[model samples]
Target: MSTPVIFIHGLWLHASSWQPWADLFTEHGYQTLAPGWPGDAETVEESRANPDAIAGHGIDDVVEHFARIIKGLDTKPILVGHSFGGMIAQKLLGLDLGAAAVAIDAAQIKGVLPLPLSTLRSGFPVLSNPANSSKAVSLTPQQFRYAFGNAVSEEESQELFDKWSIPAPGKPLFEAAAANFNPHSPAKVDTANESRGPLLLIAGGKDHTVPEVVVRSTLKQYRHSHAVTDIIDFPDKAHSLTIDSGWREVAETSLTWLKEQNL
Candidate 1:
């Protein structure tokens, strides 16, 4: 049977943000799906005008959201997720639901070491507001460029902002730092063993929210994998590799990994 692939997005992005990647995976003979986080709005415009529509979305909500989709699938699926979505992907693997998993520029998980200055700065935008605890916040152009597309060009950045950008829930970011620290944190994932399948982590060197040190630290958590578990860092890429100047390269790499696992 052909292995399926599911794409999960991170903060400030709806699942439609992954259309190009999903379509790319489809061309490669893999069944692909990108499921939105609960309460995500229909479009960037709607998400901007009223982010409340997507507020209160947490990590557990997203993981369970995709889990439901997986339950209906004809086969077990490989998961590819970015940033916060990457964290959710790990949670799915912890649940032993994935056939294989690719976490690209994945967020920090408990027990993984190293916290970069950039990672702390990326959260600076919303760290202080109590409203942000349950609110969705939009990124300013400068903020987006700084946190996600620092290495991409202006026109390309503009295109990404116009097409895939939207307000994102702050709850996950708030939960990520606490998930492993706090007993009640919902951001906690249970990737205790590699029973879920093979695992790969793609790190963007210039990513502000998940730096190389952070990705390197993730290895220990995946030590339980019986399948191949490792990380590959793209030095010139930033957090937006999937949509930035070199998306096809990232996709090709991920495709190569998936093809090896199932073909």
Candidate 2:
């Protein structure tokens, strides 16, 4: 049987954002599933209309939620995730949950150093307000432009913001930022686990949210692991690499890499 593929979305975007990716992967003969964070709405319009639905959820909540979904599947799936979801994919892989995994511009887990200024600025919306730690924060068009659409044109940035941006819980951002200081933080990952399935970390060279420096730091942490770990860099792309006009290129790259691993 063909290995199933599960797509995990990041903050501010719902599972619906992965529809095009799912369609493409399905055409390639992989059954795809994009499960949402707790309380995510079916549509971006609905999420915007009722932000409360996605509020108050934290990293642990989302990780457990996706874990349950993976556990119920007939076979371990090939996990693909973006941003925060990418970190989640790694966490799941540490638990020996997936057949293989791909993390696109993944958020940093504990032990990753070299936090860049651009990454801080990208997360300012949530970090600036302490109250936001327990609330959901929405991105302004300008913020989204800098963090998620820098590689796209102005018109395309606006369109992406309107269609995919929604409120995201602030707790996860705070937890990730403070992960190193907290011994019990959920942002911790077992990068050295030998049982972690083959993993790929995709980096966007121009991505402010997860620059190459940060991604390399993440890669460095996994260096001691016996599991297969690899990285590919798109030097001109930004955080929107997964959803921009050239998204198909990124998707194709991932598909090709997975095929090489015979997953």
Candidate 3:
């Protein structure tokens, strides 16, 4: 049977945004699927029409939802996730739930200490308001540009914003922000899993939201583990690298790494 690959999307972008990657992976003889977060609609238009449907879901909720899906699969699958999805992929992999995982510009998990100014600003739309924690928040075009499109041109940024953007539950952001303070925060990952699957963490140096420094810190959290951990840096890319015009390059890179792992 072909290897199964599951794609997980992060905040602000619909799960369908992973369709291109899924197509490419499928062509490479892999069976792939991209499932949205809990309460997500089947399409972008439907998701936008019901922001309330996307509200109040947290990091743990997302992880468990995906876990249930993984359990139904024929075998342990390869996971590729972006942004918060990346974080979720790591969490699942840490639990030995995946054959392997690729985390692209993943959000900060517990034990990640560098909170850069850009990261803060990128999350301001949700973090600025306490009440937002239980609400579904959408970013403005300008906010989207700063958080996900800064590395691309203004025109392309606007195009991306219109194409894949959606309301994201603010609860995950709040959970991540206070992760270090909470003993059992949902954002926590078992970075020290010594026998888990190999993991490749991809980071965008120019990404204002989850910068290179944060990615490096995440790498350090795996120091005690003997399991394979690798990192790739796209120095000029931003948070939008997975969805922008340069998406193929990132996808190709991930495919190459998975091939190297013989998965």
Candidate 4:
């Protein structure tokens, strides 16, 4: 049987947004699944209509949710995740649950110390108000433009927002922001595990939400491990690299990397 590939989405985007990537991977002869967070609805409209269902879910909750899905698989699968999904992928891989993982513009994990101003600004909609920590927060088109589409045209940014944006739980952001200070943070990843499978981290230089520096910092966290860990930088792309018009480029790159790893 072909190896299974699980796609995990991050904040503000519905799980179905990965359909294009999933279709492409399927065409390449891999079985793929893109599951949402613990409380995500089946559709974008439904998720927006009932934000409370998605609110208050933290990092550990998301990791465990995906872990359960992995538990049902017949064989170890490759994990390809974006943003917070990227962080989740790493955590699972560290636990020796995946055959490989590709993290795109992954959210900052524990031990990454640089918190850029742009990162703060991008997360301000939820982090600005402590009350939002327990709520599901939606981003305005303008905010999405800054956080995820700054590298694309304004029109394209707005279009992307209308098509895929959804309310995101604020708890993950709160947990990540405080990850450095908390020893037992859910944002923590067992990067020191040398027995795990290979990991590829892709960064977007123009991404305001997760800048190149942050991705680099995340890479450093894996320095102690002997397992294969690599990073790629798309200097012209932003956080929306996974869902934008140029998404195929990123997807193709990931597929190529997976093939090279003989996965």
Candidate 5:
């Protein structure tokens, strides 16, 4: 039987963000689950209007939340995460909770040093204000356009903005920046551990937040992974690769890769 597929979402997004991906996997005979981030509402509109409820959701909390869900599954699951969720998936693997993992358009890892202006600007609304640390902050339409929808056309971008854009916690971004140096930093993940499982890092070609330079730099740093480690770069894609115009292509590619492994 195919192992269950666990989907974790990034900041400003709820578990529903993975519904399309989960449905595709389900049709492929994989059991699917996409758990909400701590304090996230049950629906997109609900979460967007009530960002205060999910504020201060740090990496450690997300990691533990996913770990608990995986532990409840009948078998070890294939963990897939996006952006901040990818960061949490890295931590989940470090905890030995998954059969394998796919990190898509993920946040910076320990050795990933490149930080683009777009990435910085994406978090600008939160980090720019000290008060934002304790509460959620909304992104202006232009900011979202540049950070997430740059690869898609104007119509699709607008549709995405209206449906999925929302406020998010600022704590995790601050934590990820200093994770490598602080031994007690909760954002830290053990990417150097080779025995965890196979890892595939998927990069969006046009992603401004997680540029190719950053992903390439991470792969180079983690050159000694025991299990298979590969990168699939999707050209003409943006930061919102999961639900973009070509999301099905990305999801199919990921499932095909998994089928080659311990599906």
Candidate 6:
């Protein structure tokens, strides 16, 4: 039987953002599931219309939500995640949830250090306001452009923003930022878990939200683990690498890597 694949999306995007990716994987003989975070709207339009639905969710809530779904699968699936979703995939892997996993432009977890200026700037919308922690935060088109579409053209950036951007829960961002400082942080992961499946971390060179430095730091954290762990870098790509016009290339790269692992 073909291995099932679960696609986890990041902030500001619902599961619908993974539709094209789902279809692409299906065409390649993989069954796919792109489940939304708890309280996520069914569509981007709905999410935009009712931003409150996306508010107040934190890292722990999201992790448990996805963990329940994975537990119901008959077979251990191959996990694929982007941004914050990538961090979720790592948490799940530490729990021995999947057969193999791929994390793309993943957000920083507990041990990651060296926050770049661009990363801070990208998160300024939510971090700038202490009150935002309990609220949902929406990004302006310019913020989206800087954080997610810097590698693409202005027209393309606007198109992506209009089609996929939505409000995201601010609590998660705040939680992730304070992870290292909080001993009981929900963003903590067991990077040394020997049972964790083979993992691959993909980095986007131009990604402002989760820069290469952050990705490298995450990889460094897992260096002590016995589980197979590797990284691939796309020097010209940005945070939107998984959803941009060239997303197919990134998907194909992941598929090839999975095949090489005999997944």
Worst 10 residues of 5 by lDDT: 218-227
Task: Please give, for residues 1-263, the per-residue lDDT of candidate 5 as tens digits.
Answer: 66698998887666787989999999989899898888788888898878888887777777878888888888888999988887778778777898888988888877677878877877777778776766777777777777788998877877887777767888888887776787788866676787887778899889987877777776776675565778999888988789778899889999988988856
- Residue-wise lDDT of candidate 2 within 120-171, one digit each (tens)? 9999999999899888889999999999999999899899898888899998
Number of the candidate with higher TM-score, 1 or 5:
5
Poorest 10 consecutive residues of model 1 by lDDT? Answer: 187-196
Error of 1 at 145 (Å): 0.5
Q: How accurate is candidate 1 locally (lDDT)?
A: 0.82
lDDT by residue for model 4 over 51-96, one digit each (tens)? 9999999998998899999999999999999999999999999999
lDDT of each: 0.82, 0.91, 0.96, 0.96, 0.81, 0.92
Q: Which portions of model 3 show Cα errors greater than 4 Å?
A: none
Instruction: List the candidates' TM-scores in order.
Output: 0.94, 0.98, 0.99, 0.99, 0.95, 0.98
The C-alpha stretches of model 1 lying farther than 4 A from their native spots are: none
Tell me the RMSD of model 2 versus the true structure: 0.8
Off by over 4 Å in 4: none
Q: Output the worst ten-in-a-row residue range by lDDT, candidate 6.
A: 12-21
In TM-score terms, candidate 6 sits at: 0.98
Candidate 2's C-alpha runs over 4 A off are none
Cα lDDT over the full model 6: 0.92
Once model 5 is optimally superposed onto the true structure by TM-score, how far is the C-alpha of residue 73 displaced, in angstroms? 1.3
Q: Give the CA lDDT, 0 to 100, for residue 110 in model 2.
A: 94
**On residues 100-194, what C-alpha lDDT tens digit does candidate 1 reach at each position?**
78999998887775877788888877766867979888887778888887889877777788888888888888887666678766666665674
